[model samples]
Target: MNQKPVNLFNTFQLGNLHLPHRVIMAPMTRSRTAQPGDIPTDLMAKYYAQRASAGLIITEATQISQQGKGYSFTPGIHTPKHIDGWRKVTKAVHQAGGRIFLQLWHVGRMSHESFHANGQPVAPSAIQPDARVWIADGNSAGQMLDCPTPRELAINEIKAIINDFRQGAANAIAAGFDGVEIHGANGYLIDQFLRRTSNKRTDIYGGDIPNRVRFLEEVVETVVAEVGKERTGIRLAPYITQRGMNDPEAIDAILYAARKLDRMGIAYIHLVEADWDDAPVIPESFRRDLRDSFSGAIIVAGNYTAAKGEAIIDADLADLVAYGRWFLANPDLPYRLQHDLELNEMKERATLFGGDAEGYTDYPDCQEKAS
Candidate 1:
């Protein structure tokens, strides 16, 4: 008995987001925002509009506030000017008949003092990651400076940051985004608190799994209060060990969070797989556990080829699959996949970040490729 082939072009309804297909575009940092205030530009709008074929396009991780910023040139949702800038982006995407979600981001310990009001980056504890973040410089891809030790956030400061996230979500709505996706993954602020490796706090925000997940719970609750749960989603990485974050119990802790989020009725949970080669494989048992715990749509993104994604969706492991680098190079990715067309390889490694139209907006579509 032969089963019919699973189709990546199948339609999926994610919360209030009506999609044309299941080929979602995962968020990637291009570091090309307009300078002076880290605002989204017409160039950025064009870049997103070009990829309107995606079922859902999650914008690059955007700083929720000035203190939330970690990298160079990433957009923000903290001010009137920022909202105006994002308005252009959302307008562009909507006009192209696409739905886009702005990912609210805060770097936490994966930051440098230069980005802070005071000369200290705040985190769950005084510890820091052994990694670097991109900063503005004359260098093509910007300069990667080592992260410094951070100051532990006071309980008052933690409460303020939660308000920042809530305001950010409200601003995303004002900016005309279809919704907001909380950046709780990739060893960023939320991930910093979720794991025990970086968070050494003795306060209510750390210690046991329930305590560690407290900040996440508050942030989500606030954001969902600002924008309905159906319009809010979160990204999480249960197996990633980057940025000196190796949480021994991350898998279980995240599954617990998943159950909680399911009970909250959020839009979806994007599972970010480690992007590096030879990354840890999230076992099938874990996937099954996650599926059972979270009743909402599950979006998995990693080294997914079309066939691999189709297989995962067919198995009912995930409702949708996201593509990052491949979607960047191939703007008409869904069309290519639907017609079995060859994809364009990445333009140039040098043009991936902090570049101009060459790599950002010049990726040819299938029609152009045919010519």
Candidate 2:
């Protein structure tokens, strides 16, 4: 370990990316996109562009297709307008000197029936997890609606989703993203397939670890084909057991997937650890195992302070530490951390989702607060 002061402000390189610092802005779903079509807005661009000092900015989880969506007001990368909307965001971020990656997402069984065409969500199996999805209209505030039993996807449908992912990556590139990230974490579609609790399939897409990981492999393969391996990344949460997804098999499957991604030469593998107070502790031994498995850059995100993030970097556990809520509230997060400045608190809880610029872009930068 090259241990000459490993800290958050240290410069780092991720493939062709030469980051000025190690602090990365974690992807968070604020649900503030333009309504009806769920397109990215200029305000969203300003919001992202404000935090351009981070090493990289992973955009909020974006649906690849209408069927892939589980929540309202979350942006999409499937349509021309969506691409145009995101183009503005990318340009803003780039102009402000920031590198960003678009996160491709599909909700699977973690969706409500209202978002589906056949009055049912889609999953690896027909089982309904004890979870709820965020649903909102143009009227009142959003509420969590119970996720219903989903229809198991046919093998052919699975291939079509692979195509959807490929197209989504291409669209992300078109939208001027520096790279693309596949959302395989947080009990979503890919996580559902990787875990045993939700995926009880008899076909080739289930049973053993290899079979269950077929969907993720194919998706990564198609995405790599579309946008090259160097520009592709993935996020995985081996520890999360939310929404009835408490599968012990995920540990091995995720490890296997990490090594496979390394073999495929994917740019990075983002590991999402637990965030809440009662969240289970991820052992340092597993972190070492993961580091040995994947050669690419690793980013660990959860609830983390500067000291905690620095300690991980010094211990050679992760290359970068991502901050979610802190970055959301502080536009000049990197500056604040760099100078040990007092942080601003998040003010608009009611308008965090599906709102105007009031809560989204109105958060002041560090200099403004100091002034």
Lowest lDDT sum, 10 consecutive residues, model 1, at 1-10
**Overall local distance difference test of candidate 1:** 0.90
TM-score to true structure, per model: 0.97, 0.97
RMSD of each: 1.9, 2.3
Q: Put down candidate 2 lDDT per residue, 85-168, tens digits, no spaces.
A: 999999999999999999999989888778877889899999998988788865747888899999999999999999999999
Candidate 2, superposed: residue stretches over 4 Å from native: 1-6
lDDT at residue 333 of model 2 (Cα atoms): 87
TM-score of 1: 0.97
What overall lDDT goes with each candidate model?
0.90, 0.89
lDDT of 1 by residue, 133-199 (tens): 8876755467789999999999999999999999999999999999999999989999999999999
